[model samples]
Target: MTPEQVLVAPGRRHVYWHSALTVVVLVGAACLAHRHWPVLERGAVRLAVADQGWLLVGGTAAAATWICAALAQQGAVVRRLPQGRLVAAQFAACAANHLLPAGLGAGAVNLRFLMRCGLPAGRAASALAVKGAAAVVVRAALIVVLALACPGVLRFPRLSAGILAAGAVVVVCLAVVPAWSRCRRALAAVVADFRAVHANPSRAAALWGGSLVFAVLHALVLIAVGQAVALPLSPARVALLYLAASSAAALLPTPGGLGSLDAALALALTASGAPGAAAASAVLGYRLLTVWLPLVPGLVVLTVLIRSKAL
Candidate 1:
């Protein structure tokens, strides 16, 4: 086979697999929606009577998340990326995020985009790690601050002894596991990139600031939805609930935290004193603005990026 053909063959295979994965995810999402149709239908009915002004606010917040995400992605690396494509890639990444569990789809898209933007494979991976780490730190910090500020707003659920024991065992196993040489090298690379990012004031600000705002905007979206649905909980309380619930849902590897986040958010809202129906309405509105509304357009952007070889 010619060298060029050999090079092109792997790309073709990757595209095929990517397409197959997308199709599977779409099918799975459809099945999930079908299974939960009753709940969704109720939510939709509630939303129809919700306050339009608050819904618009939630929609605006949702739209801004993509911009913040793009800024964070750009800040992860030193080199300047094509701004337009970078934003477009983030938009596409959000859609991909919902297509797979544990953020694999979004990560894959961002990694490919970074490599296409002239980053080496290792560096691209390191950049993603840096961005993720920043996001985690920012989110955890926000949760703590909100919890403190809202005093008594968040009630921690009691864990069974078995669950506690399992968690302990998992932590111990992780601590005791010896790292492979390659894993160690990758860790070192990520640390190096993390330090490099922090050393530059502008990049550091963008990385951390963007991460913080990205999380805050998401919480705002939830809070706005709560208002739209006339939820009794205060905005601060709602934001706290959202942050805490989303953090908990992150433990479960669900596509875009779909079922997991929905359940958690509704439960949190209900637990925080909102009526069950109101909580459900809030969750539905949040999802409508953040996920369902953007899904089609985001997918279209993804397709365009792929066709243009910008991803």
Candidate 2:
């Protein structure tokens, strides 16, 4: 190609990428705005009767989730992590997670953080997998414990046997499609990393403990919000409902589980005998504490961390 065409080609490519990124950001913003419009329409009136003390408690729990996330991340790897930077990364990651679907934003931030902390790319990825696996196990255990304690309160929606069979078949087919050698290598890496993390008593404790605390703190936030909004359920029951709803909603691929989680939580709360309006208010309060309130600050912190090369 001529020198002039080559020069213009680079500019055109830049424009194409820039336009693509702009479109993604705008789409994400539009989705958020659409999902939150109902809450905005109701405004402060819905929260007028909420107990300030309970709301404060909810907000505190919401804030603490980030620290728990940081601890869990640190425990995922054996390296000594800078405490302040680790927590700051989590705070920033929260904002980024909302901008991308399926946890990509947060994963990208943490992956970069791990690499910067001196881990190779593969190890960093395996560490993330280990942490995620621990989280899932802890959450599932909590759900089982709660179900056993509460008896009939934990009934799940039914699916047809044929549907279940079909799902299993689909999963098996997908698993079969991946190259056996690649899958084996990936499994080996994950297992090796998992063993390494678990071999250290402190790291194992941190991993399991942080994961459990993170899940419980999130439920506490919901429970406190329920109290603030005068939902009639017991604290234990509210926590159970939150866990169930969140587990169900996690299957959906919305950014940070935005619209899906809200809808699921509201439906679960209402099914548990809460007044529809009260359930809606509780969900709104929970989102206000966890998402909308810290969004801008989180973004700003993310920017600062990026500029400083801390992430």
Candidate 3:
């Protein structure tokens, strides 16, 4: 076989295997949902009679998340790209994200898009890393500010504050430490890229502002869902709970945090005094607006982008 053929052969095989794995994950999620159909049905019923106006607002918020993501992504690099295409890529990337664990699919799609837009591979990857770090930092800051302002909203296990502080420091150090000498160069590149991106005032503002707004919008979506389903918890409480649960769920390696995020959200809501049924309903509504509703269109957009070589 020619060299080209050899390379193509491995890629084809990998694609087949990845497709199979995606199918398995979808089936597993379906089965789990079936097992919880009764709860879901109850929740659905509650949602059916909910305030349509509020639900509309929630849906709008959910949709706006993609736009915010695109803005933040663009802000990650100084390179100018077509604004419309960038947002479309983010929309399509959401579907891609669901097909692989730990955001590999989304990262791959964005990396390809960035390279297509003329960024070098290393720079593209560094840009992505910077965007992710900015997001984490922004979210952490929000959590701290909210937790302090609304004390007792976040109830941790019986651990002292000092212990929690130490644990957080240790975790941060571990995450920041490079595994080997070879990786240090990559780490330094990331730092340099981060500095370069933020050096531009507009880029820095877009990156940080978009990240903060994205988090708030997501929280607002959850809060709107809570209102739609008549969740007993106050809006502020629901927003805080969502931020906490979603952050915690990020630790899981599941595709889209599918099962993990759902469970964590439900558990948090229920724990915060909402009835189990109400909590389940709120989650169902939130997912319906954010995931299930947009999934098909997102996939269609993804396929078109791929076939057209836009990504």
TM-score of 3: 0.84
TM-score of each: 0.83, 0.84, 0.84
Question: What RMSD, rounded to one decimal, does every model reach?
Answer: 5.6, 6.8, 5.3
lDDT of the candidates, in the order given: 0.84, 0.82, 0.82
Which residue pairs clash within candidate 1? none
Ranking by TM-score: 3, 2, 1
> For residues 18-77, what per-residue lDDT tens digits would candidate 2 score against the true structure?
446545645765676577667544534567778999999999999999999999988889
Per-residue lDDT, model 2, residue 258, is 78
- The reply for model 2, stretches above 4 Å from the true place, is 1-44, 157-180
lDDT score of residue 48 within candidate 2: 70
Q: Residue by residue across 1-311, what tens digits does model 3's lDDT show?
A: 32222222336656666556655655766786788788878887888888888889999999999999998998999998789888888989888887676676678778878877998778888888888999999988888888887788797679899999999999777777765444667789889988998789999998998888999998988889888878998877888888899999777657787877887898899888998778888898888888899889999998888888887
* Candidate 2: 10-residue stretch with minimal lDDT: 1-10
Judge candidate 1 against the unseen true structure and give its global Cα lDDT, from 0 to 1.
0.84
Each model's total of backbone clashes = 0, 0, 0
- Could you say which candidate leads in lDDT? 1
